[model samples]
Target: MTTSTQIDTERTDILEMLAKHRHFLRLTVRDLTDEQAGLRTTVSELCLGGLIKHVAAVESNWAGFIVNGPEEAPDFSSMTEEQIAQWGDAFKMLPGETLAGVLAEYEQVAARTDELVRTLPDLSVSQPLPEAPWFEPGGRWTARRTLMHIMTETAQHSGHADIIRESLDGAKSMG
Candidate 1:
């Protein structure tokens, strides 16, 4: 196949995988109440609402990296106790945060990510990795790798959410 055709096919396949994983993740929280969605059913702190929030945040950040390079890194040393506390709860729904609102935000992020995936000039274009303890300094990643990372992140969290969901009410996402 021609280079253009190859890129087109890869793009289509990546988008399909992303959509499928997203659908599976969404299924974990479907028809759940706000309290149920936020329930920490597992020994881990993970909850369905939190997983949704985290995947949305992670995808948005990675997509931003693809379009705009790495964002300013946070200064953990300068953070206050309250700021540190807030960071720990970043994935979870805080008081007054509803499941519906979080789900809507996730949908918005997903739509924006889809548009980015469809319109980026070349998936092979590379960018420097953002500064994070979990990421190696000076590391660079291609747009294609970024999308795959997003897919893997979503799938991993989807599994965690599914387990949490099943624990919450025995509602399995898949058999």
Candidate 2:
């Protein structure tokens, strides 16, 4: 909804759903310092800052896919331990990374995505899935489907962030 163009109800719904989940995910980190944001509270390695970072990165990549189709995907099925570790780093707040920094990145990513949703000429435009073990080969996803994927991913990670926050200090994002 950035321009004079009238968005349909579906686009508005996508934008609203995205905004709602992103709120909860970000709220999970409210009042946390960088150190606390990076602290892993569960057996899982997920941290609050990392969740925000991951969500932003996911949104950015998928938005790029909507625009330009899939880029070269890493060979996850045959990754070296070091490569695997680097991939794992996506779920971490590395040294010198700050909660504020990640949040800023998330905002920029989200704005771009919202604009894409608002301005994309056709939500039915589809992109072929990148070849990967996990993805069904030859599968294609429409822009609308891709946006739903982004929303679902954000919702899933928001739940993770809520758990991390609860474990950190008994804070509940929705309660």
Candidate 3:
């Protein structure tokens, strides 16, 4: 097979996996009202709508990082209390936020990311990791690696959503 064919195949696989996890996450919130989507089912601050919002933001930021490097990212290691609090609040839906709105935004982000995966000149492009206490001092991630991180985050949060859904209404995502 040609190199182009191999790259196309890899892209297809990446998109498929991401879509699958996204489906599970969305499905967990299926039929939930705005209030229910904002409910904290567990001790965790995460809510259904917030999960959607957070995942969308993560994807969007990482996609931008692929093209623009980390210049736009805030320095996590030096964040003030307000910045840290704002980051924590990203896990919950604030007043006036609706499940439908977040869902719509997630769709928009997912669409943009899908197009990015399809049309990126090369998935091997690298970007330095943002300054964060959690990351290695000088780590760099390729576009492909960033996509994998996005997929992992989505899948992990989907599982969290499933547990939250089950706790909220006795609904199980895969059982």
Whole-model lDDT values for every prediction:
0.88, 0.91, 0.90
Residue pairs with backbone atoms closer than 3 Å in model 3 (clashes): none
Off by over 4 Å in 2: 1-7, 72-81
lDDT per residue (tens digit) for residues 97-154 in model 3: 9898999999999999999999999999999999887889899999999999989999
Two-way TM-score contest, 2 vs 3, winner: 3
RMSD of 2: 3.2
Give the distance in Å from residue 129's predicted Cα in candidate 1 to where it truly belongs. Answer: 1.2
Residue-level lDDT tens digits of model 1 in 18-69? 9999999999998999998888987787888888998988888888889888
As for lDDT, the candidate ahead, 1 or 2, is 2
Residue 43 of model 2, lDDT score: 94
List per-candidate RMSD values in Å: 1.9, 3.2, 1.4
lDDT of 2 by residue, 1-175 (tens): 3443444777998999999999999999999999999999999999999889889988998999998897734557778999999878989999999999999999999999999998999898999987787789899999999999999999999999999999999999986
Model 2 has a clash total of 0
TM-score of each: 0.91, 0.91, 0.95
For residue 25, model 3's alpha carbon misses the true position, in angstroms, by 0.4
Checking candidate 1 for backbone clashes, the offending pairs are: none
